[model samples]
Target: MTAADGVAATVDLNGNFPASPPGSRSKKMVRDGPQPPADPTAVGVKKSGVLWADLDPCDEGRAPTVNGGHADTASGANGANGANGANGANGHHAGHDDGAPDGVPAASDRIDGVLEMLETHPESRVLVLYTGGTIGMVRDQSGALAPLRNRLASRLRSSPTFHDQEYAKRRFGDSDTGPLILPVSSEGRRVLYTIREYDPLLDSSCMGIEDWVRIATDIKAHYEQYDGFLVLHGTDTLAYTSSALSFMLENLGKSVIVTGSQIPLWELRSDGRDNLLVSLLLAGCYVIPEVTVMFGARLLRGNRTVKVSADSLRAFDSPNFPPLATIGINIDVDYRLLHRPKATEPFKVHCKMGSNVGVLRIFPNIPTTAIQSFLAPPLKGAVLQTYGAGNIPGNRVDLLEALREAADRGVILVNCTQCTHGRVAEVYAMGKVLWDIGVVAGADMTPEAALSKLSYVLSKDEWDLATKKEMLRCSLRGELTAPARVLADWDDLDAVVRALGAKPSQTASLLVPAVTCAAAARRGAGPLQAVIDAGADPAAATMEGRTPLHVAAYEGNLEAVRLLLRHGAGVHAKDRFGRTPLVDAVQMDRHEVIAALRGSGAHLGAANPALGDKLCSVAAVGDVQRLESYRLAGTDLCQRDTCGRTPLHVAAQMGRSAAALFLVSSGVDVAAKDLSGLTPAELASAAGHHALANALRSRRSNFCT
Candidate 1:
């Protein structure tokens, strides 16, 4: 905040992130029978090891979310959204029981759902979770389950259907499964596409925590290198996987979308094509920063999403949270629901999660271990999910000790309210107790923020107890609001007006006024001839700061200054800031004005609050030629300002090139320094004027230097 140091703007990641393939591919054939398509509404269902369901309603041509109402479905021949999963080195699973219900669905029904999603959310990252679905499965020699003969990359390459308007054609190329990976650019941001078949021998049904961990790791590693992420996850446990990842990542500034389809791609009429396409579009260009799950056309927060129906395509719903965005015919992003990164510092990958961290959901009568386990030594942090405004069930001694001990040990204990509208700090005394004991308050911060904050803190190299406590008290983002109050006034109008009106002694016409006043007092004819020529009463002069004579005096007008003094104008009259005419003249370094005042016998050195070092700088830089007239008037040459910078110091440091030669020739010290410890020579050198510097360095005339 200081003048020397300003705030740093956050960095933007533009050149980084992955890109898609370019060009077309030749047709490739696969000898495989398509499996029955699963009902989109089925829950916990996996068809050919793939899950496809309509998670939420969508807006026109956009993904559906909690905030947006239903978007009209689109009708057309749809193109894949061009979203590709990371390289899946582990191959696709084969012969797995496709999680579809017993009925065969027309391929057109599935495609219709996907087309609607693609049209609704045109700009998104669509991850096609190819978990050996109907299209991927083919019979091996042993009649066992295995991926079809053709690779997904080769399939994408054969078709030029995937393309975004902003991408350069050269930036994309053919893929292994025949589906071209198209890299799109928007407003300088980029996203890359590649099928998940990089894992040449794995399947989604066989996916475990390690697989999820790997997927999350890949996303995190590339996050700084990219703006968003899209994951191809099996729909069987898609919600669980999404929720797990939502809780895992920290300070996620990009989007993480998990999506898969119900039917296989090679079917006469398949839903997988549109679903994969829509998911890809949603993941690639949407700018909301958070974790999301895309099924059919709808996108939901990974953690908040729940699979509601077993067969119908629209499947996921965010019960307690609003959808960050909706894509049906058009993408409508709700900025409010999305979590944005504030620092833009850089995306950091925190692969390690303190699995030991516990969450205690407070109910009316929870047992002691619920609180006790949180304070245990092994625990790094705890999310004390409390009622509205962080109210505890009861202030038990055990609970208090658990909370206090956790905080004292540098374990960040966060208080997140059960209610949604307000934060914990505003309503409860219990919240204050936690704060007093060093427990951090999570005011209005979503569970996401609390979890993310805790992970961010614990992952640091230095987990200092004091630092953690301080970090919690301060805001990382402008999320918290402070109370407002009134401030006191410090007006200086009177002072400024007085300064404006004051005049220096050099302009004061006092002598002539004194003569007239003397003549008047003696009852003389007031010099009838003198009075006539005088034109007006010289004694009728201004003593306040605004006299016409005072104006001339301060301006170094020696002729006018002397005329006023001679007219008997008072010299001791003080301006509003208590400055006399002599003080004003001396402050301005107006030697002629100073000389004129002294000629009239005015006080030379008196108390004056208005005179300062800055005024001396003005004096040093002002008209130095006025100094010659002062000498003729027999004025003192040894006078100094508050900083002990005499008129000579002013003449040497700030004196003009011509005036400087005159002053030094007249015996002024050119090397003289003020209280700032800067000599005239040093000042010239600092200013980078080489000639002036050389002049100051010459020892022959120390006066000029």
Candidate 2:
């Protein structure tokens, strides 16, 4: 596909492209309420659009046509900076400001005040390129007829609406050489034309192989004639034209503004006036050095804009990019986004385009007819929007046949994912289908990127299939994310931990697959380690019901519990759900880990505040050595476990005399009270433990000292 091929298909008609939807409202005025703080670097005022001119002035008034004014004359007496020779200190005569530069007004700037500032000049040639639109239309006895340029100029000069605009004041000056109006007519009502006073329709879109050749020849033909060039175009395929021009216009130093209005100038609330004013400002200025788009108060690189919305006044938005300049309460220019001119003076233009483009979107249950249609097309290039990680459903012969046919026909198919985030790759068995069928992976490019890349690829006449394939595999403009999912074998749990480490929010950011990957990797030392590594505190407990220690104990992972403890996992931590590790273990009946936890000084009863009696019962019924270990490890001997029996009371009640003796020897007073206020000995006596009662008496006598 070559630039020539794309241009060869162009139909001759009104050159302007699609206008914005009707009845579209402008963005609500910023001045309706309290004003925002002013910024000096603002790009455009609301009404004036923008004023971008190079700082230098020409002594001979022979400025560069693209960046400088269209004529040798000055803009106005205080409207525009004058030629260097005219600079004398006569109170803003050319370079000085003794008083208000222009006599229009002294108030602060407004959204609609962009054109009013030009009244300061007397000698200015404001050529009006009147592409037959409502602005140049007047109703005669016959009907609506295109008015003459001079008449249009007079109407503009007298209208208060024009007075409110800054460009009108600067260009007309309320004096001589009011405002020049030149009318241009095209074929249809749908497609209007915008032309300068001279030769028109030399836009990149209008350039064919022959047109490109001629445009290149024309620049050489009129090398020293014009000041600058401004192109008016439709938005639909503007990027393709811009990209073509950027490639063709090599080492170019002048500015070219490509813009068209959403609403026709004939409409009462049209955007044409603003778009026109700004385009001229850009052309007459000396600052802009590359191909640009001036529309709806924003100036963007011609290649960056995409028509994101169909009907809104803001029809175009550069989603994956920043704007070059924005016109609003004030014009704001992002100097960084602008390209500096090349040192070389002259530039050559190459006008060529390659065709053979195709695009495909894969979805669930995609029909055979749809698949066959794309494969059968006259396509040189294609982009396929695929499923997760570039996967396709099971081998439907039709899907395979369509893809195979396209590849067989020498058409390039590039795979891009439908997912907004993450890359496409061979994650599942189905993903290998596109890879096997010679479909190049796009990694993670937006649809706009896919289209732009396809256009660029097809534009180069000499590039081969192999070269095109390689280009798709590579990243352009930082659009794709490649070599995706390095931790394919990771476990979900581990992924959750890593996600916690990097993003501490409770809501999961990485998807289910990522979670599975994290879990498969490693148990990750311990919950504490995972938590701490994920930027969470080792001491943090679950908001719901369990600390990591509680979970570990409940799961019978004694080692995990120990690791948590060693790393400062709070053993005494209670969950918001009010369960502790020991309590959880007991509830789950994980006796071994529970016994181990008890040995390690875990307070099982404390977690529940009601498990005292149960702990005592378990101690008596279980191994005596483990019981003693629990006691030595700081279990409360006098406190009742869940069953409401203190250790001594349990021992006496069960007639475990040796256990009773150990409790007495371990300094558990038999006189300790239960809920009934009955001492252990009294409860024992009531149940007939006379020996335990005598022992309690002896203990009381010994403690009397």
- The prediction achieving the highest lDDT against the true structure is 2
Backbone N/Cα/C clashes per model: 124, 75
lDDT of 1 by residue, 1-705 (tens): 110011111111132211111111111111011211121111110001111121111000111111012110010001011111111112121222333356733333333343332222222223333434334554579966466544665665454445432222212111122223444333122223545553543565676556657777777544422324566555566665665576456445456777655555545455656666655655655444466877666677675565666565665665555566676667666543444333312244455555556666778767778677646878888777888788775557677776787777777788877765567773567767767777677766555445555655565657576687566555443233333222122133334434656433312233334443333323223342254244443223333323333444555566555444544344433332223455456544566666666555444221111112222222344444444433333333333333344444444433345555555555656666544455555544443444755775673444322
Q: Can you tell me which runs of candidate 1 are displaced by over 4 Å?
A: 1-192, 198-213, 220-228, 234-255, 260-275, 286-291, 295-322, 334-340, 344-347, 418-426, 429-437, 443-449, 469-705
Compared with the true structure, what per-residue lDDT tens digits does model 2 show for residues 521-571? 234444334444553333333323244566666556666665555544444
lDDT of 1 at 613: 22
Error in Å for residue 287 of model 2: 3.7
- Worst ten in a row by lDDT for model 1: 70-79
lDDT for 470 in candidate 1 is 63
Candidate 2 global lDDT: 0.46
Return the TM-score for each candidate structure: 0.39, 0.40
